[model samples]
Target: MTIIQFPTAPALNASEPHDLLLETLRAATNQLSQAGKALVQCDSEPAARVEAASHLVSAGQSIVAALNAYQRGLQHASDQAAG
Candidate 1:
């Protein structure tokens, strides 16, 4: 098994879940943009560019999880408002 290590940014610092969600979503957008550029620019070898883009896309997993949490938070808030 080969283990590849990619560069990682520092963890998000936020007191609230919404703050983390927003920060995560923003990071995901940046990663998606860079991934698109990687494929569009083709600055490196085809396989290398694909690999780099794949890593970038994978790095955005936190966004997916954060979005799920954010949706739940919204639903909870809405339920409270309704009651």
Candidate 2:
């Protein structure tokens, strides 16, 4: 099994919403990387491997979208606080 190393950030309280979101994104990215490695090393039947690969791709895309949205939200909140 391949182990993917994910960077660890300082723990934050729930009240730190932006930090919490960032941490969640980091964890998700690490999980996605691990899934990709597993798919590459998979020795299952061709059809099952293909299906798992497809699901991983879909999940990765979703994570990217969610990360983008979270960043936008953080920016908006910062702007609001400034203005």
Candidate 3:
């Protein structure tokens, strides 16, 4: 089992939506990585592999959504700062 080390999370301030989005992105990425690892370890069992593949697909979708949300949050912050 490979442990992924993520950088220290920013302090959560209720006023900062970016911090929350960043945390969501990190968590979704970690989940996706774990799902990929699980699929790799499914061995020769076709049923198990299929189940793992399903989980991987779900994780992939989650990461994509998280990334999009984070990107939008950053853009919003930039716009606010530019005002």
lDDT measured at residue 54 in model 1 versus the true structure, 0 to 100: 85
Number of colliding residue pairs in each model = 0, 0, 0
lDDT of 3: 0.62
Candidate models: Cα lDDT each: 0.69, 0.61, 0.62
> Which predicted model would earn the best lDDT?
1
- Per-model RMSD to reference: 4.7, 5.9, 6.4
What's the lDDT for residue 70 in model 1?
84
Off by over 4 Å in 1: 1-7, 72-83
- lDDT tens per residue, model 2, 1-83: 33333333335454454666666666556656756666676665565466556656755775676577677888888999999
Model 1: how far residue 49 lies from native, Å: 3.4
Instruction: Give one digit per residue, the lDDT tens place, for model 1 in 1-83.
Output: 22234445458896666987888777777666666666666654767576767867675676778889888888888898999
What's model 2's overall lDDT?
A: 0.61
Which lDDT value does model 3 have at 61? 73
- In candidate 1, how many Å is residue 36 off? 0.7
Once fitted onto the true fold, the runs of candidate 2 whose alpha carbons sit more than 4 angstroms away are 1-44
**Which tens-of-lDDT digit does each residue in 1-83 have in candidate 3?**
33333233244453455666666666656666765676676666676666666666665675677568768878987998999
Could you tell me which 10 consecutive residues in candidate 3 have the lowest summed lDDT?
A: 1-10
